[model samples]
Target chain A: MTVSTALPAVPVTAALPDKKNRRGNRKNSTLATVLLLLGAVYCLFPVLWVLIASTKSSGELFSTFTLAPSTHLFDNIGDLFAYRNGLYWRWMANTALYAGVGAAVSTLVSAMSGFALAKYDFPGKRFVFNVILAGVLVPGVILAIPQYLLLAKVGLTNTYWSVLLPSMISPYGIYLSRIFAAATVPTEVLEAARIDGAGDWRTFGRVVLPMMKSGLVTVFLFQFVAIWNNFMLPYIMLGDDHLYPLTVGLSGLLNQGANQPSMYITVVTGALISIIPLVALFLGLQRYWRVDLGAGAVKA
Target chain B: MTAVTALPTETRTPRTATRRGRRAGAPYSFLAPALILFVAFFAAPIGYAAYLSLRRVKVSGLGLGAGARTEVWAGMSNYARSLTDPDFLPSVYRIGAYGLIVVPTMLGLALLMALLLDAGRTRVGTFSRTAIFLPYAVPAVVGSLLWGFLYLPRVSPFTDVVQMFGVEPPDVLTGSWVLWAVANIAVWGGTGFNMIVIYTALRAIPTDLFEAARLDGASDKQIAWRIKIPIVLPSLIMTFVFSLIATLQVFAEPMTLKPLSNTISSTWTPLMKVYRDAFVRNDIYSAAATSVVIAVATFAVSFGFLKLVGNRAFNQED
Candidate 1:
């Protein structure tokens, strides 16, 4: 920054940000690199540990260095797959179902609510949005027991809906959606659609939905990771082991590791297995991770 | 769909206003699902909690039969007991200390990582960003599980790596380091989202701000501290409030770590106490009171923090 100020004829883009600052940028970048690497190590170490530990046989798990990879990789996964009628796989599928389906529906719900809040000037719009603001502050723990009881009233407790239903309406998602709708979807287009005799629903489906795609993706990922990582809700909601998501399942396995030490290996293996898809999803979908979700639609 | 229609000086314009009046109902219809869910899952729970907090079953002589106990109004006794409990205060203090450690460091690391990523400086920014965010994908339980194993003497690579140097790995899940262990899990899970948020706000800053700052002979560090940080302070506050709220409700990591360590208690944090009251002790009344306290504290602290910072990002209504 200072170099650009100090120099007269530096090409702006290639502007040596500040010749003196060049040294600073280099130092800062180095510090930044090291800090980032430290963060990466902090994050990746445990994951890396799990990866390596998952490969070791139960015997080797406690006998050797933790980072040393063993040849029992396939065996550990095979053992995990074989355990309790392949409940591990069921948990994985259930997690995918929870996160994937939950996020999709959540995104739709939030999108609709946000669009309404942003686009329509309704009598109770302010009131509704304020309620959402309050909702955002309400902790999930407070709702868990009540959600269970409410679902129990409808005889839906322990069912997938108990978990899925509560997750569908994310206040944060709705908040983000409103911001996106207000910023991106111009009122003129909706008015034009109205002038062309398109109904509100039709216009929303055709014109508004497309404009909201990017923001919706962010909403989807947020809800996706949230539901995927959620432990307590499903832990309380689902009783059947078959319905257990990875978090609850792995935790259960870890609790058993207290008594049966071999389960530690399984828990380690399961932890590694559980993280694979989400990490892959996060990495693969990096393009969709709009740093500015609000900005995504601004271009539209 | 209001338009300044090219109209003659109309005798009356109530038609457009009436049309808008009729259309106004449509937005509520769209918002109905969210409202219904909010009422059912959010409002009703809170209402129920508060209601139940005021009532508790009192058993008579033997404390035996179905009708032996009757729900009676306990007034604010439950709240008083919960508030005054020795365990409660320490848990709050622990969470305060934990929050102090987790919030700033996590947000700082996150902000720095975000700015570095945004600067497009290094080759591994994308990789490191994803690696850092990878924990976000890992559920707190799973992250705790992974970290818990890493902290174990037998499984820790640090244990083995240091054994070569004739030293044991520090018992991270014990002693003062336990806080760091829990905070580390939080930092890992939280930093990415906060980073993304602060990054979003940073990205929202008009480039002209940077261009002008650059023209002022500001260094990149100065530009970040002066221009970027101030511009994104709202985001920082937003993340801070969210982190503070989340820290208050710290649950899974410690709960998972409890099986691995003797250090963590059932009431390690406030919500953990709430969980114990709600589940283990089957004392939802006091649990409800604790929940109310936590919710109020969150609102008050978040609101106070926002007011202090004068950040209005969360003040949006509809």
Candidate 2:
């Protein structure tokens, strides 16, 4: 009877503000919807330009309507392939190897280090973590020159190792893994594993590893994309055209295009093709990356 | 492979240290692979470059042989020469000009988009947001390549469309417009990440704070400026720092685009200058000196700006 009396008065109390809230929300939403569509169009325009541009023939590329589609993508790709004995294929493969293999190894290294740092008690742990943080601030570009010289000293320059070896450290990846480990892995479970006679290595490999998988995947993706997008390190490291990744190989072609104006079509076509795989990968993996990546910028 | 070779500890004695010290070994052990590579590649090279910068080849008798040319102390001469070189100033000036165009436009678009996303009324919000961020996955080299071809008179569909109106298409790769052309590429590639950063900070905000404003009949723009912007100011500062750092290191786009344009010099950027000195000129000393200069400039600018901003960005953590 007391609750019934309180509810009839409560409904009137809520009703006035609810009416105002609905009006406010309706106004806010319509304005938001228009703004969002405009922002999306600005973002998508360049991509649309490339798509339509890629379809046209060399002569039609500039001659046709900017948004109009033509039928030359297939021929443009054929031309791209025929150049330098299909060297573009080599670049694609090289990119996959560098990013795919390097990110995988880097993620594993970061995961183990992060797990140990987060779960285990150790001396100088603070110092180690701080050092990793320091490494993060130091731009990778500064390290590139020295890295090149060092690799050259060991006769590693012009080889794939020149690019792959340095990328595998990823201080940032380790920093991320540590955060992930702390958040995802429960302390009591690991302690129980140790008490149950499981070795440290076994516990990490079996018990902690599975728990850190999602975060580790995020770490791997970050590193993979970073390595794939990396231009300077690979640009400076590899000299052998045969060893060039897509970036270096494509840049070489662009350089040659200055003298041969017609090669512009080929470059545009290649750009369109190159983004296809990663765009597919991004769309596929978008759901898993809802976590705040800003907070996740690896401390390295 | 690194996975196999780096596995299996070289020394296994059931590693022991004090509780505080025990974690020391594991991080170092995990970091060992990175450290070894770091030293071999990063530290050693930086040291070598510094060492090289302080020394130069003393060529004797027309520099006939390896013996005739000896590495001797150049002692600030290469740095002095590099500093006085007139070519260096224009690169700095150009970057300043380029940064002026890019930083504001990119961040402005990012903030606007982030606010819209936070407004939460748009359909396919996820799809749109992801599409905007898609270019982030494309490498700088790839991004530049895409834009480079689009800038071509014969290759630009926009040019085709513009020409249909009977007006000549603008030459983006030409003088004056080249900066915009390059700046556009940076904007395209960078806006997504900044949007994500800004968007993440917005998402992290407690929602009930806005519920009151809604009751007060606040417009979405009013809520964004009066409420959201103030709340995410720190993230903005954080983004500003990162964007500043990234802008200084801009190299590959111009470097890649240079092959297609005569306007981009061999020394179009500070980093590019370093590459040319080291590899092209075989002046490792000069390259080292230039790199150290750029690195110092980077740190100085960042720390100095922090001081000017009253040191708030990094104040709380310490």
Candidate 3:
């Protein structure tokens, strides 16, 4: 199903000869190593700080050394869980549902649309593609207010559909899927499927989807992270805290931290815990995060 | 394949005609979902925003009953008010300043890190790449909160270290420094993603090109400056345009930081102003006008940048 499986293989050593480059690049390599390490430390600083900060009780948070770790990690999690009758867990679950379902549906829609645009020579293809390209440029935040108003007219605002529906259509995902479709799925295979009496739907299901599997993973992850990280759409749409995603919930929690300093620990703990699932997902799918913005431009 | 080719000419022609007929309708069926959603979400909202921007609520008397507060044509009045609103211009200026600070520094660092990573002379490549890109996984809200705490004097290691040296650490969450403090969180969160983008483009370049340059006695820096950068210029331009667009829509970071800081106002950015106008002030007309203005300006900047750069990034689509 992966794109690599479709390609002819080359000898491994010829493709990646590691020993030769290491011997001559030693001197400058040290400087590059140091600079990269510095960048890594800079990036990791706040994350490390948050980890330590979350372990501190509200009292130790301000009084103790900034880097000092404490034994309040479990207590902080317990406290965060107990806050407002396990609302934090609700937010976590809502975020998962929103991201997981939204991305899954969005990916499928993108795949279908992309496959049509790529494989079939339909009327208005250029216009359809151009419109979607323009969609990619539109500032999504600008659309939030109008989306909210329009949804409210139908009384769909403040509901889960308000957030989930908007998250479903991603122009960028469709655009990327088109590129993937053109690159990975061969016309010959599709033609073969058609000759064997497979319908268009069957061809897409059996032939196209599996071939674009890796590329679709990239699109799914992009949309997943985007929906997971989105603040405005849900913040503007949903009023019920139970329907709130982690971003909105945690933000509201920090807003409360202004009145009660103790809420700061809860916010910090919430922030720390919220990031773990995404960070794990990100790391696990590290190799698939190949994003080349100039991909179409380069080929053309 | 053999079966398809071995079919009789008359039979094949009829089947081909039927297949062509089916193919004509197939793409539309496949595209139905995306098109429906696009019209409902993207096209409709934009049209409604534009329509609402041109109209306003006309209160006949005390504005009490249903018929009393009727919607009517306001023409350019809402647009005029939005443009002339005192909070609007300053937010624009502030965003201008923020973008000026964010786009270059972030992209510059991204390009540097990408070049370094592509150099293949580095140690702990995986660790460095992972660490730098880690911030991307953290939502802007959480990233802002983490930095918000880091900016607080009582809990900041920077403040602690400065006190150890008998020097006062400047408070980052107050006065004008808060702007850069917010900008710093953005740069920190954004750089890694941009770096990975540029690095992906760099990896796409053929290795023999670099091998040829090295054989010609060109240093790594020389190869990067003269060859690699020029080659990835398209990606750089694309990233720049995307970064510019993102910079204009700054919201979550500042909103998250509001609780921790005194300086960031309800109208700190243009989007925030739109939010305040629509929800807080209950003025949808003006909000719609401002949203249109922001959307138009984004289109202008994006198109203008693309045109300036020969529109190479998207010209390939045609």
Candidate 4:
């Protein structure tokens, strides 16, 4: 199993003679730059609008100039926080717990299963991998209703475990983990650890995991974002507002906005706050998102 | 290679046999948690859904007593009802239109941006890339909420700009325009991630592969069309499949826009219908049947797509 570990090559176009191609190249570059900047503006428009809009009082939200800044940002946040004795903050905490703990456990599970699949020669390995791959295509809607029913039978519905347990087994994570294990953790190190009288578990814990650290970080981040962004599973499983994630909580708040127009301001403010952690995480860990869909397809 | 080389030296030792035996069992132990979770969460739910889809409650004598409501085999009645229901087909058609609008436009923009970014000719590439990708960090619910407000004429800058031209801005959340409005939210939230995926694939292409085209005096557009696109076709196919799957399950965005817009019904999408049935109306059997139909359709579409594409994108080695 060969892994493509080639570093990105510097573009040959960069070294082209500027004197001759300058006219054509500059024209093309300007067009590309303008197009790209337009795209950037289109994407950033909403986020900027939200930031400016959240600062307005409820009365000003519809009446004021669309882009005008106001002094009611803290007031809106205060109303959001003060709603129903701080239910919004509880949703925030629930989101953190679900994404944080769920991703951590999912990463560990994927790492272990992936290492085993990559390293070990065993009966039914192909069958195991194939089954898990099939799980990837199964729609979540097919599972969510039944999962809720089954969990209801067990009295686990509307609980934290209802959301977290279903999130642990991600076939995509295991698949990526397998690739990372094969690419990063060499067979020699495992053999050396075994020869040095270390147990398999210890060797895996001490050697294999650290070697797959960056890859595992990628896995963790993907799962973290997935759990954080997930609305269907949690929305189906948990009924209690106290246990709702930001997605469910905000949607519910918006539902109430029909009667009370003031809830729209709170909803907007909550939306602004809800996106900060993830956008920050995404920006900080920009380099870790090395997604190559063709990697497995072209090679495997 | 080291394992094979070390095999000759280790085979003579009796301890090596036991070690190999233990190693054979190690993978199963390692895989146990995932397997257990898979069965409990994925396999069990799917099986239970299928089972429940084939059965229904038989309520006798005005449905007054617990004993009168007996569980009985329903066969295909639920499926028959679901397929013939007025709401089900329209939801499917709505999503079909939604997918048609979303998948092409989003992927086209994604491909265009990816090619432009990979061309390395753009100024503010980093800023555009980050900014475009920022929407992905926002959840669908939040993204929809933001866009829902933006669609409101009273609060919309687009409306404000149009009014300056002595023209009225059409209500985006009404009529056929609402479809475009909903589609725009999806396109906005999705284009960045797909762009990054395609961009990553583009970056992986060896520069030498394209240097020859450059030497031949081929234009950037020609090289992008001729060389770069074919190389990333597999990634494109992959993103298409994922995007199609996501498109079929459009719920949150439309659901979020519901309060703001009366145009969106309770059954705006098939998944939404399933949600309405299972939770809202307490019709789990029909919901299960509809979900089964959805699951089967998803499998058929994905598998059929792969097969139609000659299965080149996912030819796993044994």
Candidate 5:
């Protein structure tokens, strides 16, 4: 009870500190700021390096000082575009289709299943929920090979369905949606909707879906990043280069960097481009990021 | 639907019975899509993997005919092979060591950063928070690539600084140092997200609780250690368990760095070994057994942590 009331009083109490004690707080804050900025620097160093490094030409990438920026960003991007008949752009598009569409459908499915589990009283609800809870703990990448073999048997291995299908059902998404539904969607409102002669599907679409929109967006972002960052699943499943996502395709470029040092620019350049979309998403939707590790059981 | 409507007439009111009948099948219909996908992708694959684990390709009659080799039940032999393989134990040991370094160090840093942010006295809190959390967006492969180049002698800015001072930079991507190098990448990528979780939990603590502590003259450090730590223990523990599971299955970082260094191999970690076995070596039976072992171990560790923590954080909502 105290915790519930305490949540609302947080910002008000934080801003109510008296002026007399502010002097003592200033000293400690300086040290805290320095320590935090140090962490910030460590985290931002690589990102900064990528920004500067992407500007170098292939010859300048190795010859010049590593952090020094050269005026070749446009040329490198142009080269990346022209490489292999614009393969890099195909990878970018493939990643968008995988993460964007995959996350959208997964969020809808999770919303439906989570709404059912939370709002409805059914016979096997506990069993269904427990199975999903256990699925949340299962190391998903462990199933990659088995899924590959099974898909191979069904002749679905080399197709987009192989990646999109497995990516659609996120146990973690369903789990979060359940929590959001129970917390935000009131039983009384649901009963009122039913009393108005609304069917199950209609109530869900009209009432529950709007209430769960923000939470569903959170679910979408989570699954989007999960699918986007995924390397092993698509790495193992997709055999064709044209069908590969950015992570897999870029890693392939890195592997080629071992023999041809010239390819290092492309790998670095590709790595730079791949992260821009994610960094933009992260910065833009910063508020929607609520990570409950217990939901996903594992996130990377 | 029939079952709900056919309940004993004397035992139920007509209105309640009719309502139950209307709502009886709705939940299942809504759950149908998820359940179908789960069975097809989750349960079926697990069951098939278990089936393959206990089977092996049997070769007979000089293996010369059209049906020279056939898959047959091998009982526990595949499990024995996976367990007894020379690569298995070392991979497990390496990952165990890596987890020890990662889980504590990462969580400790996360806790410290969260406490500092919660202190709220600093002007840099919001900037530091966003900057630190930015790496969570970068994929592990990209993070590894960026760090791998930074570890290189020719391309490292740190190397440039060291050479100016007439000293050689320590080899970070070779020998035993490579473990820490890989561990560093994981820490760099993970610390920010965990920090955000712990920080969010900290923000939920009512400031009035700390007002009394401050009146009693508690220092910031003292307040953090005594008050905030206990309050956010559940989030800390949850993050720790999740990190342990993730660290055990470390794949992308090592795989990404393999092109740059010789220290990493096909079996640098258990998951990497599973990938190598199933794909590179074409040993599906052994790979399935190894994967099952890893999966069971992950479940046991995660649930064991939950049990130790009394399972309150997850179930308390219910």
Candidate 6:
């Protein structure tokens, strides 16, 4: 790994020469490239289909070829906006609000709790850590029904708080933040801050947080994507269409496709539009996408 | 708190002891939010689900007014009903089949892709990696919708391609093929993320370790089979476990595809059965019992698999 990193821009294939049988090596390498490209095509086909499908009108959607692009992109967008007096835009905004606000608050809470678990010694710490770890394995889908029932008892169902409140408590976020805090924030610096008459909160907010900036961004992106992509929780929690996130909203539109054939185009358009933000986030934050599952990040 | 930090440590007094007490309290104070949320959302829900599973609604005389139907203890009747429901066992079997198809295929493809990318010979590694991972950014609902359109006869370019060769396209959304259809959706969305994980692990292995194998006249496939696969077995095991968990809880893809396919029942999977029992059939008690059953099964499968495997992947004792 170090050798490959040092020789940047030199392809790894260039180093595989055996000083004999060059043609056979070239053929094998070409085969590998073709096989990889085929895999790429398989993965990108659906995304490409959605991109082209969203450009077609209701009539052209069934009438024209699947891959052919039409000039109805703006018309489809206009129709999606005009449907139910701009309800699609509302779903988009609701999704952004849920992911943005939920992730922000979740990140802060996880940072605090994870910092405590990583840096400080207290009674029952191991118990708390083990329970949170168990929470990580608790399949979140199983909790949806019970959470809905409990929230309904308190008259909190079908409300934004039903989704946002639960979204703010991500066990995986805390686990990642704990690893990040343990890795990035040094104990010597923390002790120095404490010796300089800084309180715990002040030291954490001013010093520890800055060191954990990249990891916290990773945590925020992860929770944001999870909440954004979530369907079952919001589907069970919110009864009203106006409160629906993109997943629930688009699914409802797809469900309506059995009766209303035109909704197929709308669902396609909504799916295409909904994925733009996530794909953009992925491309822009490519470096922070590293999730070291083998505990290497902490051990580093 | 700052004042306590400023106090002199030379004099071991009660004030110092109080500062030590405050230090002990700091971690608890910091953990207050997570602990509260965990208790409310995690622990409370599981407990309430168990309680609801053990109880049922008992209707009184006439069963008309607000107080007519009261909640009462039902012992194990709800669990008995849920376990005996004809839909329940089939749903479990369907999920078992789906997991068998999905977990191995997805992880195998993921492992293959990771090994190919790690082989360091493919020219399109970066492009293919991003393209394959692009689906992870798309939501399952949206991904299913896209694939659902592709499965349709009128909208599928695949059908056109097959027809161009004078062959009929197989109906992918039919009863016989719906499992594979849903499994494909899972594989499409899951493979990229797992590939990245395995690829990250593969990258962590030093190139020098494999350089010696190459110098010994071993081919790329031989090197990957002998050296790379064994070194990344832990990562593969971890991915397999996670894929198993996710496969068992598949709800979104099948739910999204139900609008298109007649084969998918309202209770297609165990989680979906829980959904229908709770929301569609208005049987929250039975649903609670079924969810508990599914949760227990999941934990058993996961922990049992780990215990059987001797926990070599996650041996972090420290």
Clashing residue pairs in all predictions, respectively, total 1, 10, 0, 0, 0, 1
Q: Candidate 1: where is the Cα deviation over 4 Å? A: A1-29, A291-300, B1-22, B164-168, B212-216, B316-318
Best candidate, lDDT: 3
To one decimal place, how large is model 3's interface RMSD in Å?
4.4
lDDT of 6 by residue, B215-253 (tens): 798998898899988887777777877788888899999
Against the true structure, candidate 1 has what lDDT?
Answer: 0.77
Docking model 5 quality class: acceptable
Over A23-86, each residue of candidate 6 has an lDDT whose tens digit, in order, gives 1243336777787788789999998888898899899998899899998898888888998999
Global lDDT of each model? 0.77, 0.74, 0.87, 0.85, 0.84, 0.83
RMSD score of candidate 1 (Å): 5.5
Task: Enumerate residue pairs that collide in model 3.
Answer: none
What is every candidate's C-alpha DockQ against the true complex, given to 2 decimals? 0.36, 0.28, 0.52, 0.50, 0.45, 0.46
Model 2 chain B lDDT-worst window of ten: B1-10
Clashing pairs in 1: A3-A18
- The numbered model that scores best in DockQ is 3
- Looking at candidate 3 chain B, the ten consecutive residues that score lowest on lDDT are B1-10
TM-score of each: 0.89, 0.86, 0.94, 0.94, 0.92, 0.92
- Tens digit per residue, CA lDDT, model 1, A40-82: 8877888888888888889898888777888888888888999
TM-score of chain B of each: 0.89, 0.87, 0.95, 0.96, 0.93, 0.92
Better of 5 and 6 by lDDT: 5
> What's candidate 3's DockQ score?
0.52
Provide interface RMSD per model, one decimal: 5.5, 8.3, 4.4, 4.2, 4.8, 5.1
Q: Which scores better on DockQ, 2 or 4?
A: 4
In model 3, which runs have C-alpha deviations exceeding 4 angstroms? Answer: A1-28, A297-300, B1-13, B315-317
List where candidate 5 sits over 4 angstroms from the true fold. Answer: A1-28, A292-300, B1-19
lDDT by residue (tens digit), candidate 3, B1-318:
121223344434576668757877998999999999998899999999999999999999898978998999998999999999999999999999999999999999999998887776755566777889999999999999999998889988888788889999999999999889999999999999999889878877777888888888999899999999999898899899999999999999999999888899999999999999999999999999999999999999997888887866663645
The better-scoring model by lDDT among 1 and 4 is: 4
**Model 4 stretches astray by more than 4 angstroms:** A1-28, A297-300, B1-12, B315-317
DockQ computed for model 2 against the true two-chain complex using alpha carbons: 0.28
